[model samples]
Target: MVADAIYSCLPDPKEISPVETAPDPEDYQFLAVGFWVDKGTADQKAREYMTKIRNKKIGVFGTLGAYPDSDHANTVRERVRELLKENDIMDLFLCQGKVDPELVKMMAETMKDDPHHSMTPERRARLKEAEKHPDEDDLKNAQKVFEQIMVSLNN
Candidate 1:
């Protein structure tokens, strides 16, 4: 979704700039960027561009489009291998189209454990007041129902 969010913000592919400064690998240590490559660009030239990004110490990650390849799978693999070898870049790999159900369950479990994903502190404080004063039975019941839904998702 980060890719979608970033892509939606872009004005035009040309305006996005062909080359970006090597982002600090540590700051963007596990970053992944997906883009559409022009069919005319030679694989060698593409590898050269990836090398430039690698020199900046950022881990360059991307996915290749299938449409350009006559033998799509093999072409993608060969191109990926060529880029890896030439760029001295590691940790680059293909990305999946959607999150799996298992991953969704895992995310649900993670959200339950992480307080930062929960209600805001101010909201929690108000809820705490409600708990002590025992007002608004309907709101309390709704909170219980929300908690059940979260629990069910993880299960």
Candidate 2:
């Protein structure tokens, strides 16, 4: 969704999703990379693409499970930024992404019997406190952020 917005803003955008293959920097002067956060950083494929990019104009965007402004999210952002190397990282657009609740439930069930499971009072409270997020505002804001980066880069 974010990529679609960024692509629309561009004079000519070649839409591609980097998965098993990374876009060759030689094919384009500028690149927009988007990925989902995993364990406080870009997932493995995105990280692979990031390392391959060097000395190019780059726009970064992604989604995360954590609220955009939370400390955990901020720390993840910092770690995400670290993914850039030898490139001009123009900007980052972050938004909350839906995580599979089934995964969470599975974890809870699987760890319920684990001796090492730390279902501390605090952890339990935090889990309960987390609410459904990434409303329309988050999606809109992410698109806006990507558009702004495109405008700035064009200038």
Candidate 3:
């Protein structure tokens, strides 16, 4: 949904490709990549694509299970910034996204005996809170941010 919102805001002569099948970075003047954070970092495919890009105007947008303004989110943002430090990054936007309930249940069951397991009660509650996200407001914000990115790209 976040990617969809960003896609809607893109100008003409744009091409959309999955991170897993990334195009050559030099082929485009500007590149906007959308991804979801997994295990505290940008998705593996996104990381791979970022490594291949240099000297390009880049915009990154993504979703994560943590609250958008949380320390965890900030860390993820910084990680992405580090990956793109050699490039001209236009902007980065992140927001809460729904967690996979089945994955959460599996983790809970598998770590039931580990008192210090990562999935604590508070973490579960935060995941629950994530379920309502990537909502209308998130989509709107993504569109707005991407529009601004386009404006910057043009200038």
Candidate 4:
């Protein structure tokens, strides 16, 4: 969805696609980076790439099961911005994405008899809260952010 939004705003989006692996800085004037939030910041792959970048224009975006303006999201954004301090961080956007209840359950399962995954009341409640995510509003907000990034890039 983020990609589609960026492409929609670009004059020739078909000819442009974001790089998955770290890209050569000389190849593009602008870059749109998207990632899934892991822990308190970007996933490992994204962190690696962001750290490698220097003196380039970058837009960072991510999706997680938290509100766009939530404390968790804010911390993640701060961490990401720090990584891009040496570069020109054009913008950033965060939005909730569907966090499957099953996936959460499985993750908890992996914790396997651990105190946090023991089907405890607290854990169950947390799971329930997490289950309510990635709704329509999140997608719409993310798309809007992507469009804004495109506009920022153009300027």
Q: Top model by TM-score, which number? A: 3
Question: The CA-based lDDT of model 3 is what?
Answer: 0.87
- lDDT by residue (tens digit), candidate 1, 83-151: 545343333333212223464456456776677444455534433443332224422433343344334
Q: How many residue pairs clash in each candidate?
A: 0, 0, 0, 2
Off by over 4 Å in 3: 113-121
- Give per-residue lDDT, candidate 1, residue 22: 32
Residue-level lDDT tens digits of model 2 in 38-111 = 88889988888788888888888887766677887888778877778578888887877666778667767888
Per-residue CA lDDT of model 4 for 32-102, tens digit only, reads 77778877788887777777778887767777766677777888888989978998887787866656768
Model 2, runs deviating above 4 Å: 112-135
lDDT of prediction 2: 0.73
Q: Rank the candidates by lDDT, best first.
A: 3, 2, 4, 1
On lDDT, the stronger of 1 and 2 is: 2
Structure candidate 4, residue pairs in collision: 97-134, 98-134
Better of 1 and 4 by lDDT: 4
Candidate 2 clash pair list: none
Q: After superposition, how far is residue 139 of candidate 1 from its true place, in Å?
A: 36
For each candidate in the order shown, give its overall lDDT on alpha carbons: 0.37, 0.73, 0.87, 0.70
TM, every model: 0.29, 0.78, 0.91, 0.72
Q: How good is model 2 by TM-score?
A: 0.78
Q: Compare candidates 2 and 4 on TM-score and give the better one.
A: 2
